[model samples]
Target: MIGAPMETKGLNANRESKPNRSRKEIIEKKKAMDALLKAASAEKDHLSAFPAFRRYQTNGLSAFLESGRGDKLASSVKHYIQNLLKANMEGLYGSEWPVEERVKRREMVAPEARYIFVREASNASASEMSTMSEQESTSASCVEKRGPMVGFVHFRFVIEEELPVLYVYELQLEPHVQGKGLGKFLMQLIELIARKNQMGAVVLTVHRSNSVAMNFYLSKMRYGLRRVMKFFAKHSVMRLKLSWRYVSVSTRNHLRRFIWFNKVVNSTLFTKGQNPAIEVLEWIIQFQQNALIIVI
Candidate 1:
């Protein structure tokens, strides 16, 4: 009888300890997430960390990246964004665009919003040609002559599904700049920023009607579908998990040859044939190799 009481007390103690341990783990996770978000938000300029990505020059296209805040966006910049979004996305949204545009305008002005503006460097003024390091080119407040804006990416760091993520709200590029490897370059840089900040993933949404955008993200960028939003039936969430280590390999020659890519055209997510998932793995292997950094 005496031993039975002791056994009961021991069992009760063990049961109590399980919840306590779980509670401790939950608290630790929350603390870690809070710390990650705080650090990410504190950094004023993500592109500044990646000086190499500041300039993308290839295929006769030259551009530079500068950071901006949504709330501080000049009227001209806001107008450009609205027009660009409409130009690129209206066909996909059809009759829903005006309402959606209003929502996007409101979202774009949120204080937490962040932007990486891509500007034409080919016609950059003499002052813009001079090094901006001394003046901190990454500063959102720094006003310098940036050649006509060609593209912009608006993203934010937020917790999604209990994981810290860099959520890309907008990636609008002028039609003239499309297909010049600039889009791929921008996404690569964004993924690097996410990894640098210990984010679990880079998340975004794509419309079903936008086949080109869908193919670009899933096939070229290695993003997988997270899920379809319940309310936004026309949109699907896409995510590129950043926890995976980047594999380094040279794929330029392989891409030029298109030997394997030719075989998988019928296997991708969109109507236009694309390289298959194995091809995606091949891209994953070579993706990091292209990430060259030149800190100037």
Candidate 2:
């Protein structure tokens, strides 16, 4: 009958309209998400106003810290981050991470992140030094003119494993700056920031292939490895509990002396063409321990 054809046409029209309705709903949901993210970013910007700048001086070098909000300084910060990563991690991750794509991803997630820039006090210009006190830089040129940035650390405060933590995303220092105790100095500042914010722990991820980083985080800094249930094949997570009593300043000083002593011992052994035997290392450690106790 004629009515049968009409009913079929109506059903087909309804089927077509269903997809349009669903598409409209999806667009509305995306809009809502965008709005929510903007509000959250605003809130984060408000809360990060305290401790605006922390100055760190060590080994005759000075690093000025400033909190970064993703929306405000994403361009300049991303530029620094990209340059650092390309210099440091490109070889480690291989070609799997194209710089352009990686930079884009970092910029997308950077709105809530914090940054510390290590600048040589003697080399830095007035404009570069001004960034130390400013909340956020509006121009990327300031970072560019500061000569080669010596180092940087990116971190954010988050809740993981049901506890508040300060998570370090990346810590990169130039080749010349490495082995000068600047890395440890930066980590100490991060811990202080965590304690100031009442975070329960400090967490970071390391690439297994980067043995130097692994040794630095595990042996030197005393960070414990966490079994990462879901992580990239080459990466591992490390955590340091902040809930316990702070590692005393004396202990930190002892740690620094131990690190310096080991470096000297290794250099001496290598230069003298002597095998770094277990016995020799043990003896050196024991002697250093005795010396530290005496100093204490």
Candidate 3:
């Protein structure tokens, strides 16, 4: 036993069973990663996130963008992007912080940004079909860091029965871009667009796990009408159906158009060119003040 090499316990383990060392550890890590992925789904397409997602895990999609117009329950996620620029949720070292916030603190966050607008058909009534996949529609809008896309809130609307049923696509904000109330602002901005377009009410969907978004949408009491119901068995979809009255151009009659969100949230938002959905959210928040307090 004198010459007996001090068997490297872990090294021996690796030598004999490197590939099968720890199933328990592997499973737990997998679960943690899945939850992280689920939590970070909204930010899958961030500019800084691209390299990390691609090289770190080799997991990503081509739809990946620096940023794009987000879901249209009435919002401009561009606002979300701007706010995320200051999300002070974390730091880089000593302790792990939100990937984006840490990136922001050091000024390492990619200034690389893009806006995905709801590319609506110029004329939905046109004779041409937009997509071959059973009328699956798409949108195209200018991408700008400056303000060419000002005044008008670029929105995406789908016309049904000659009435525009707006499409609220999913939102993606990188971990580097969380916090700073961009989420709420995005919701309000979308409603602003809906108010302007003379389109029907706004409709959007939130995943069950996305408590942050659900809470924001639920914050609008008027928005939680039948459209914002628990109707879906597994997931929930909120539809904001508006009357022709709300879509009026005067913008003064704007608040009057809000049949549901009326007197809810910030009814003051009913003012000209204001986002009626914000009032709805306010209303919803008031109805269930404690509801929003408690995480779903």
Predicted model with the maximum TM-score: 1
Model 2 Cα lDDT, one tens digit per residue, 84-185 = 778887786676557544553554356576666666544554435545544333236544544445787777655443234566767889888788788987
The lDDT values for all models are: 0.66, 0.52, 0.33
- The alpha-carbon lDDT assigned to residue 269 of candidate 2 equals 16
Once fitted onto the true fold, the runs of candidate 2 whose alpha carbons sit more than 4 angstroms away are 1-53, 99-104, 107-109, 123-148, 229-296
Q: How many clashes (backbone atoms < 3 Å, residues ≥3 apart in a chain or on different chains) does model 2 have? A: 1
lDDT per residue as tens, model 3, 155-263: 2344322233333433434442335343444455555544444434455433334456545566643354232233234333333432112222211111221212221
Model 2 lDDT, residue 237, Cα? 33
Candidate 3 matches the true fold with a TM-score of 0.29
- Which stretches of candidate 1 lie above 4 Å from their native place? 1-7, 122-145, 227-296
lDDT accuracy of residue 259 in candidate 2: 20
What's the C-alpha lDDT at position 142 in model 1?
38
CA shift of 63, model 3, Å: 21
lDDT of 1 by residue, 58-135 (tens): 787867788888889999999999889989978867787787788888888888899999988645432454565634
Top candidate, metric lDDT = 1
Clashing pairs in 1: none
Model 2 lDDT, residue 48, Cα: 45
> What is the model-wide C-alpha lDDT for candidate 2?
0.52
